[model samples]
Target: MPARYCQDSPDAIASCVLEDMVLLYHRPSGQTHMAIAPVPEILATLDDGAALTAGELLGQLAQLYDLGEPEEALPLVEAHLAELAALGLVRIA
Candidate 1:
């Protein structure tokens, strides 16, 4: 099976939109992250607490945004998920 990712916890982070940026405050780490575009959208998609593969996430996002080609977006989504995982914002499940 492909790797699956889930957000750390709904309570672990607090977020708000400022202009075009999404500001995320991670309570556990007391750190804030500024995100743009699909980062914020990715976090929001994970907010439902579903563990999803990059392909699954791309499908969900495709419903809400015109991401062009899924083939192109898959790697980008995977990269974003990996980055989020490294930041402790998300975890592999």
Candidate 2:
């Protein structure tokens, strides 16, 4: 889904930081999720109200974080997106 524009699901998700992890509450689904590091980073990036593809997100992440190699980070970004999407915290456009 790298080429697809992805955005956070507004109104359905709420988040708070808990130590090293972020606790996400999906109001609509009544589900709670715990995320660390890149998960919270991805959410914060999308929280800007901008829709971006996985590659674009990876670029933003690279600027804000030291994710070793860009090539390796792509899959990691995709994985985070998948997890967020599954939890109703992100949507593809």
Candidate 3:
């Protein structure tokens, strides 16, 4: 399970209004880079530079996608995370 970068729109994903988004980038040589989205200037209360973890990311997904609980979202999140990591989108943190 690896992340496949949408070559057509590598940087088109939007970030949160109050939080930063994490992205895993895969290079042709089979390496992954974790690219954290920077908070937009217009967005307030998003100054912290801390990177989001899997659990935290699940929470974000729960909120953004209106899921009921982090537990429920955890599996999906983990799957995607693992996929991304496998494809050199990110490394397990």
Candidate 4:
């Protein structure tokens, strides 16, 4: 299954950065979520207002960070996308 997602606005979610860790607050839900490293980067990529497929997201992320094999990272990326969706930070498109 290919997962795709996008963010409407930065204001919809508030984020704080502490070194590699990022704290994300979902304003509508009034819930706070924590992310680190590639997680934050992944959100930022989607926050650009473009719905991206999991493969596209992985390709973009690979450019920024060294991700081994796409086959190896696909499952991991999908898992992260699921976590992001669970947080209400992203949605399936």
Candidate 5:
């Protein structure tokens, strides 16, 4: 399943995410929130653009997975990111 996640980077970044759908969330408080949705739903939100990175997706995945630090989240994110990339939901660059 496309997992829910949350992350707070030292510097806020904008990105997009998809599991079942596409969603968008910016680090308003340097914190990013995310959840799983459908690809079409996400595409609707992405009418503005295509392509999303881990930081762009919004839900509660990071927290859901217990990924705490960039050091920690990096690996976990890499795993999920690869999963998303495989599904064509995200691009690493």
Candidate 6:
């Protein structure tokens, strides 16, 4: 099975959209993160806290944005998720 990822606690994070960027405030770590494009979309899709594989995330994201090809976006999504995990915005499940 593919690895799954989930967002951190909803209460632990606050976010706002500024133009094309999303600013995320993580209460636990007292860190502010600036995200753009797919990063914001990825976090929004995981707002429900449901663990999802890269492919699953891509599917959801495709519905919200114009992602041309799932095959091409899978790797990019995975990379974003990994980065989010490192930033404490998400975790591997």
Best by lDDT: 1
**Poorly placed runs, candidate 5 (over 4 Å):** 1-67
| Native-referenced Cα lDDT, model 1 | 0.93
Cα lDDT of model 4 by residue, 1-93, tens digit: 666787757688889998778999999889988888778888889988889988999999999889999999988988888888887888887
Tens-place lDDT per residue, model 1, 1-93, is 899999867899899999999999989889999999999899889999999999999999999999999999899999999999999999999
Clashing pairs in 6: none
10 residues in a row with least lDDT, candidate 1: 7-16
| Residue lDDT tens for model 5, 1-93 | 334332333223354655453344444544344545333333333334434444444233443344456665555554665654454444343
Compared with the true structure, the alpha-carbon lDDT of candidate 2 equals: 0.80
User: Which is superior by lDDT, 2 or 6?
Assistant: 6
Q: How many residue pairs clash in model 2?
A: 0
Error of 3 at 47 (Å): 14
Q: Comparing 1 and 6 by TM-score, which wins?
A: 1
lDDT of 4 at 64: 87
**Reference-based TM-score, model 1:** 0.96
**Cα displacement (Å) at residue 82, model 4:** 0.7
lDDT of 3 at 48: 35
Ranked candidates, highest TM-score first: 1, 6, 4, 2, 3, 5
- Expressed as tens digits, the lDDT of each residue in 8-92 for candidate 6 is 7778779998988889998999999999988878988888989999999999888878998778888899999999999999999
Highest-scoring model, TM-score: 1
Q: How high is the CA lDDT of each candidate model?
A: 0.93, 0.80, 0.40, 0.86, 0.43, 0.89
In angstroms, give how far residue 93 of model 4 lies from its true place.
Answer: 1.7
Candidate 2, superposed: residue stretches over 4 Å from native: none
Clashing pairs in 1: none
- What is the Cα-based lDDT of residue 35 in candidate 4? 84
Backbone clash count for every predicted candidate, in the order shown = 0, 0, 4, 0, 23, 0
RMSD of each: 0.7, 1.8, 10.5, 1.4, 12.8, 0.9
lDDT of 6: 0.89
